[model samples]
Target chain A: MALDKQFIGREYGPYRYTLGEEKMREFTLAVGGAKPGAGTPGEPPAHVSPLLYDEQAAKAGPHGGLIAFPSFAVVFAIRPFSAAIADPALNINMQMLVHGEQDLEFLDVMRPGDVMTTTGRIADLYERARMGFVIVTSESRNQHGTLVVKGTWSAIIRG
Target chain B: MPRTYQPGDTFTHVRECDRYRPIYYAGASGDYNPIHIDPEAGSAAGLNGNILQGLCTLGWVVEAIAGFVEDPGRVRRVKARFSRPVRPEDTITFQGRVTAVQDGRLTAEVSATNQRGEDVLKGAVVEAFIG
Candidate 1:
């Protein structure tokens, strides 16, 4: 069975998310971030992986305070889309669904403690050959209402 | 201090995909697709064994660029096409070069390959604000 083409442009979620510092640290370490204190012995050295640990990066970098990797926006923005697909209306065959391609465009940096809201929509739905494709685009906005990130997530399902 | 980046600068970072990468990424990113964490399920589904998530490999690419740029927030955009599945224990290498600097944005053309020299991410591009 083919997915409902009407689900295209169907919108879901202006979900709220507050970024956390601990999660940022954990994600950094899990992705093979530099182990701590590899800094110079005699010096009060600069912390490695400032992207995850350095407040100075906030001062010198784009966003301040304890920061996160660029991809953390996925965590903030993904929930609603996942919920949308699971709503049974789409009839997504879980066993046959495959992630096709993903991309992100950053308009503003997301920082820890920023209360972000994400809204997602089924951007496109179409069929080619025997496969059904759904493209979901989500936009995350920071507390200041700045559009922090916009991402497009594509899933291909067997028809 | 934010170091100035110029075009033609080059660097590389190598990551060894630990056995638990997919699991951790799954927990953190909320993509609990069984192919990434359950070996039996994946093998039953003909993947041979559990495979790492594609976005996790994309994370590695961002890490490499962050290390080079020295500021995670400076990264403005990242895009990649998953050309191959990344398995546990695979050593993935990312080589990047500053291809252009126009206005305040710096562009780097990045390429990713596994230890066997198989292309895992191709035509990858990253843009960051250098100003």
Candidate 2:
């Protein structure tokens, strides 16, 4: 069944999330190729910038504080796309769906203790080569109302 | 002082999808999709085995550029298509070439390949502020 085009403009959220220091480090190291074990997120990899894990080093660096890895925005910004796909109205076949593409634009750095609010809308729905494509666009703002991150997410549902 | 960048500058980064990485990434990213953490589910879905989260692979693209610019905070944009699944025990090598440097910003094209030399991402591009 084809996805209903009427759902294109449907909005997902004003989801809010509070950044945490340890969580940021854990994410950075996990993606940076670190090996995690009991009671630790693992050591930061040699190539990972200290700005993402070392508080003191980051504080002394240009940003003057610990900054989350750029893609960390996906943690909160993905809420809407996740919500849209899982929405019962869409009735998407979960097993046949795969993430197709992603685009993220970071307007400013994100720091721990910063409160982020995200909202997104179904941008488009179409069929290509017998497969369904669902596109969602999201915007995340900080406590001060600065647009910190923007994302375009696509999902392909196999026919 | 910020480092200068020019078109044609190249950088590389490599990562291995260790057996437990998907599970660890699931814990950290809140993406516990069974296909990424459960081999049984993956097999049922026709993947043969578990695969890494596409976003985790995207994160590596960010790392490649962040390392080049010397600051994670300077990464301005990253975009890519998931062309293939990255499975456990697979090693991915990312190579990036600076494509443009303009208006205090730099743009680069990145290619991600697995050990078999299959492309895992397509149209991968990253941009960062260098000034």
Candidate 3:
């Protein structure tokens, strides 16, 4: 069965998230290939930037403080897209769903204590080659109302 | 002195999907989908085994550019299509080539390939600010 077109413009979230310095470090290290274990996110890899994990170093660097890894935006920004797929109305089969594509634009650096609020809407729903595609667009703004991130998330439902 | 970058410049990064990486990523990213953490669940989902989160692969793409610009904060954009699943024990190598440098921003086209030589991401592009 095809996805219902009526939910095409369905919207999700003004989800709010507060960036934490340690969480930011953990994410940066994990993606940087740190072997995370009990009580630690693992030692920072050599290639990992201090701006993302070393508070003191970051405070002394150009940004003047710790900054989230660029893609850390996905942590909170994914809320709306996840909600859409799990929406009862969408009736998407969890087993058949797979992330298909992603686009993220960062307009400003995110620092600890920055509050981000994100909102998103289903942008399109269509079937191609017997597969269903769900596209969603999201925008996240900081407490100061600066647009910090914009995302285009896509999911494919195997047919 | 600041570094200079121009079109045709290239850089590479490699990542391995260690057995527990998906679980750790789930803990950090709040994506606890069973298919990513449970081999049985993945098999039931037709994946044969648990797979790494595509977002994590996307993060590697950001790392490639951030390393190129020498700053993570300078990364302005990253986009890609997930062409294949990255399973545990798989090593994906990311190779990026600068395609444009204009108005203080540089764009690079990136490709992510597994050890088997299969492309995991298609149409990958990253942009960063240098000014």
- Lowest lDDT 10-residue stretch of candidate 2 chain B: B1-10
lDDT of 1 by residue, B1-131 (tens): 65777889997988877787788777667778998899887787677888888887888788777777777777888888777778888999899999998998889989999989998887788888775
DockQ of each: 0.52, 0.91, 0.91
Error of 1 at A152 (Å): 0.8
In the range A15-39, model 3's lDDT, one tens digit per residue, is 9999998899899988898998889
Q: What is each predicted model's overall lDDT from 0 to 1?
A: 0.77, 0.95, 0.95
Model 1 residue A48 lDDT? 39
- Candidate 3 — which pairs collide? none
Residue lDDT tens for model 3, B1-131: 78999999999999989999999888888889899999999999999999999999999999999998999999999999999999999999999999999999999999999999999999999999996
Name the weakest run of 10 consecutive residues (lDDT summed) in model 2 chain A: A43-52
Angstrom error of the Cα, residue A142, model 3: value is 0.4
Candidate 1 regions off by >4 Å?
A33-48, A54-64, B1-8
lDDT tens digits by residue: candidate 2, A1-159: 498999999999999999999999999999988988889999877888998898889989999999999998999999999999999999998887889999999999999999999999999999999999999999999999999999999999988
Residue pairs in candidate 1 whose N, alpha carbon or C atoms collide under 3 angstroms: A58-A64
How large a fraction of the reference contact set does each model reproduce?
0.60, 0.90, 0.89
Look at candidate 3 and tell me the lDDT of residue B38. Answer: 97
